[model samples]
Target: MKQDVQPLIVNVKRYTLVRNLVFGWLTVVLFAGFLLNFPKINILEHTARNLYFHVPMWFTMMAAAFVSGYHSLKVLQTGDPLRDIRALQAARIGTFFGILGLSTGIVWSRFTWYVGTDVWWNFDPRQIMVSIQLLIYGGYFVLRSAFDEPNRRAKISAVFNLFAMTALPFLLYVIPRQMESLHPGAEGNPAFSQITHPVMRLVFYPAIIGFIGLFWVLYTQRVRVAWLKYRVTQDSEM
Candidate 1:
C-alpha cells in the first residue's frame, strides 16, 4: 500500500488562524505577566513573575511529551510514517520547551532561594529528576539515529518515546513530591495553592493555554516541513 500524505498535510488557513491567535494570545500574556500586580511574598516579590513563563513551560513540555507519545502509540499500532514524523517533531519541540523551563527555573531559584549564595544547582529533587527526564528523552533521539531503515527507526523510536512518556510523571511530579525539595508541594512543604494568591491563577491558567497553543503551532509547522522533506528525500528524520 502506498503511504498517502493526506493525513500529514495541514490545512493552511486553519494553521494561519491558530498561528495568529497564538501570537496574539502570548503577546497579551507577556505584557500581562510583567505588568500585573501580584501580591508580594517577602522573598519572591518581583521574581514571582517567572511563574507565568516557567511553570507553563513545563506544562507545555508535558503536553508535548504526551502528544508525542500518543502519536508514537499510533505508530506502533498502524506503522504510519506520518505518525512517526509527528512523534519525532513533538519530542523535539517538547525538549526545547523543557530546556527553557529548566533554564528559567535555575534563574528563578538563584535569585530567590539561593540569593547571596553561589548555589546554581542545589540538587533539588524535582530539578534533578526533571533533568534526568530530559536526558532520557535525549536518548530517544539518539536511539532514532541508530537505524537507517525508516520502518525500523519508527518502531524502535516509538517504543522509546513511550518509555520516556511513562517516566515523565514519576520524574517530574511523583518522585519530586516524595523527596525534600525547594519546589512547591514537596514533602512537608506548602503547595503553590497554599503559598500564593488566588489572583495568580488568572494569569497562570491562561499562560498554560497560551504556551500550549504556541507549542501546537510550532509542532504543526515542523510536521509539515518534515512531511515535505520526507516526500522529497524519503526520510522523515528531520
Candidate 2:
C-alpha cells in the first residue's frame, strides 16, 4: 500500500510547476496583489508574515542539505570523486540560503522584539544559536578551501558535514521550545492562528512552491557553472 502511493507523490512533486502552471501563476499574481493591498499581512503585523520568506529559507536549506547528504552517501559507497564535488556544491547552496534565512529573520525580529533600538541585533537565544549554526557551515566551507589536497578536502568535508545534524537537534528542536523568544512562534507552540485566512492560504501555498522551484533552478545553474569550472581546471592541469 505504501509503495503504491509513494511514486504517485514523488511524480506530483517532481512535476508541480508543470502540472499546475496556470493555477500557480494565478496564485502568484493574487498573492502579489494581496500582500501589497494588505500591507498588514506582512511580518510587520506579526511574525506569522515571516512565513513567506523564513519558511522558504529553512526549506531551501533542508533541500540543499538533502542533496549534500545524498551525494556524500554516494561518495561513501562508490568512492566517486565527482559525488564529493556535488556534495560540496549542495552544501554551498545551503550556506547561501542559511545566511539569507538569518538576515531575513533578523529583519523580522527587529521590529517585533527590539522596537526603537538603535542597533538591530540582540542576544535572543534562538537568534544567537542560529547564528552559530550559520557559523558551522561557514567553517565547513573555510575548511574545504583551506586544505591543499583534493582528496583530503573532500574526506574532511564529508566528515564535518555529518556533525551538522548535531546542531539541528539543538537549533531546530530545543531552543525554540525552551527559550522565551521574541519571535512569535516556538517549536511546538502555536504563535498566531489569526493569519491563516482562506485567501492567504491559497496564495501563500503556491508562493512557497514557486519560490522553492526558483531556488532549485538557481541551484541547477550553479552546479552547471561549477562543473564547467572543474572541466576548465582539469584541461589546464592536463
Number of colliding residue pairs in each model = 0, 0
How far is 233's C-alpha from truth in model 2 (Å)?
A: 0.9
Top candidate, metric TM-score: 1
Give the deviation of candidate 1 from the true structure as CA RMSD.
3.0
Model 1 stretches astray by more than 4 angstroms:
1-8
Can you write out model 1's per-residue Cα lDDT over 49-154, one digit (the tens) per residue? 8889999999999999999999999999999999999999999999999999999999999888998999999999988998999999899999999999999999
Give the per-residue lDDT of model 2 (tens digit) for 82-174. 677677777777878878888887887777657788557877777787778778878877877777777776777777876764565578547
Checking candidate 1 for backbone clashes, the offending pairs are none
Candidate 1 C-alpha error for residue 113, in Å: 1.4
Candidate 2: regions farther than 4 A off: 1-48, 187-199, 235-238
TM-scores of all predicted structures: 0.96, 0.74
